[model samples]
Target: MSSDASSPLAEPAPAAGGGGRLVLGCTPIGNPGDASPRLLAALAGADVVAAEDTRRLHRLCAALGVTPAGRVTSYHEHNEDTRTADLVAAVQAGHTVLLVTDAGMPSVSDPGYRLVRACGEAGLAVTALPGPSAVLTALALSGLPSDRFAFEGFAPRKPGERARAFAGLADERRTLVFFESPHRTAATLQAMAEGFGAERPAAVCRELTKTYEEVVRAPLGELAAWAAEREVRGEVCLVVAGAPAATGGDADPAALVREVLLRVEDGERLKDAAAAVAQRSGVAKRELYDLAVRRRAE
Candidate 1:
């Protein structure tokens, strides 16, 4: 907080306007104790609450000892697109609409993005009540490099496609974070191991900031096996180490050339097959393609 004489914090509060406002409130990602006092006041004072799930919002409000002063309209995945104009209209009409989601900040892999964008387009003041974020939480706990990181959301759902996607990131030097579903986590880890190699260190953070939260640090292969038999629950975020720079002593280039030729032999298209081989072997596609042509000609 700046100590200037005319600082905004020191300015007298303005009266609630008749035809303007929206509050993009941030709720606790997990623990109720994580809720900031500003969030509590926002919920209690807003004229309308547009939440991802009204029941969940109610539960949160109950835990915080806040009985909302106005109605809560559902603003979620199924209806956010259609509901944006109406919600924006309410704000234009002077209703202070409060937005929240199941976890973390809404609009981040959540539904409030559209509404927030709409409000911005319509010249309404937009601000956040910043609070807990799982992405930051998981990264801090993962024991991976955090000075620079990439959030890729989630991996592709298909098995082979997912592997190819991971393979593309095999050269990324920055730590990578991702969101994963409970059911698909095992397959995700397996694909990651295949891409980054089973030896790459990674962490699986589950139910972050909650009572049952867990963080497992191990090689991707070990995590994959650990996930196979368990009924993993809650939201999961994974932190994966970026690919290590190659030294002089990796697998022989002749063996890699042989592998590329084999994929082509198995009815994979020259173009598609070349990409997959390039991903797996960390060899440039052009180099592999030249070797591929030479092998085929012979």
Candidate 2:
């Protein structure tokens, strides 16, 4: 059951003694204007403000022009494990503990999961003031299918591991999103090209909502080539179209392979041509791609 959108927000019945609860607030991903009014109230009212970076929390407060009337403390990955118990105890002791990350919601590829779990297990009251998110922001901006999507946070750093990971998702039918750094963006894109097929449609979103925001939509191979040519910078959100649905039709394998090869000869990359034909003819993409490449070499 969900609340009606038109209904006024109802305040939850406070834990015994009128307080002792955990509040997870989302900071702005990039822009300060996205901060919600409830978030502003939480920032100024919570008894204890636990931030991924206390300095950044201060910066955000400065930008929002609201000073927190609480004890500011650090709660990041390195200290989350050690500090979880204390934060939980604070909530139990009638303290309003607000957990915030540097940007976006905590525990989504960030800290706060352990504390949230601990608080939940202790049967303490916990809530969130939702705001901005990079995953949804990038997905909406990518112009890709949004109904179904998967967020693969930060592609594996190692080459072999990353390749295997991408290979595992090669046949996925839902759109895929990944977080990547500027320096590794080119290499990661190239690897995705090889694993998911060269022509798979994708978009590289950079510095979302920031002053120099940029989004480049193209095939995986072309994006890879573009990244390789220059130094890609800023935060990167890579969104790739999923593999086409398998039709399970009785399309002749030989005929499909020939069709793929014809497109290849018509100047399309072999993988791209194979994927396009596979989607339409219900042929196995990798099989058709392999056959086309082999025939082309011959």
Candidate 3:
């Protein structure tokens, strides 16, 4: 037997033992079954529930048999700037504000960053209820290296910009993850192939955790061709393997230092440039940074 909307689950109570805290609740990406008991409780008892989409929140509540005993308001990109102040005010008034998005955690390619930042600046407590994340889910399902991965929320829509973005990360050693629209998946994959090379290993995870979920893993060129041949639908995540490790010789500190310098000249910070080049080139970050600094001193 499955629990329904009218089941005898205990009514959830408001968060206790905290003062003026903002609770960032992560919602299910697809399956309602992924909703946590604590999430249901938070929904039922928060003083103010700020959701990216109120209709979706209601649907989730109906599925979970939860009746939010709180004021529900819209908090999306359009109104995030104006609403951040109001939501922060509610927290300042000692109310538990539950922030949720249509899917996944707030502020991951979604709204809620402003409100969270406001709360932090106001010295109000802010915490999260971790839950399903499409990034991690797709990465895990991608069969790509999860040990070191980067979640770049969404790719740029334009062809030129998107290609440039991929070019920037072309040397990134850590596996790269990105979100894309269903309609643009094929085009994006094609652009990726152009930037990252046609033979690079990649995966396209579609409709994750939902019916008709699909994971297509292959070289960038093959994935691009596959996507073009079909009408790809549903939420999409792309995971691309990192650049292959350097072979045939020992790691070159000088080359690594020069790579870091080149990245820095391209507007990246020295530390960030060094870290990124080190990862892709298999050079120690500390050693690379020291060499770059010494070169700068020369």
User: If scored against the real structure, what TM-score would every candidate get?
Assistant: 0.81, 0.79, 0.79
lDDT of 3 by residue, 1-298 (tens): 1221221222223446647789999999999999999999899888778888888888899999989887777788877767778778778777898999999999998998888889999999999999999999999999999899998989999886786677678768899999999999999999998777799899999999998899999999999999999999899999999977664255556656655776676689999998987776677779889899999889
Strongest candidate by TM-score: 1
Kindly report which residue pairs in candidate 2 clash with one another: none
Q: How many backbone collisions does model 2 have?
A: 0
- lDDT score for candidate 2 against the true structure: 0.83
TM-score, structure 3 vs. true: 0.79
Candidate 1 on 1-298: residue-level lDDT in tens? 0111111111122227665677888889889999999999988777767788878888888899888766667777877667788778777776777788988898888888888889999998667899999999999999998999999988999876676567567668889999999999998998887677788999999999888999999999999888987887899999998767653247445555655555565567887777876776577878778877887889
Cα lDDT listed for each candidate: 0.79, 0.83, 0.84
lDDT of 2 by residue, 1-298 (tens): 1111122222332344667999999989889999999999998887778888887888899899998876777787777766788778888777888899988899998998899999999999999999899999999999999999999999999987787677567768899999999999999999998877888899999998899999999999999999999999988999999888645574456546655665555578888988987776677788888887787678
**Better candidate by lDDT, 1 or 2:** 2
Instruction: Report the number of the highest-lDDT candidate.
Output: 3
Q: Comparing candidate 1 with candidate 3, which one achieves the higher lDDT? A: 3
- The local distance difference test score of model 1 is 0.79
Whichever of 2 and 3 has more lDDT, that candidate is: 3
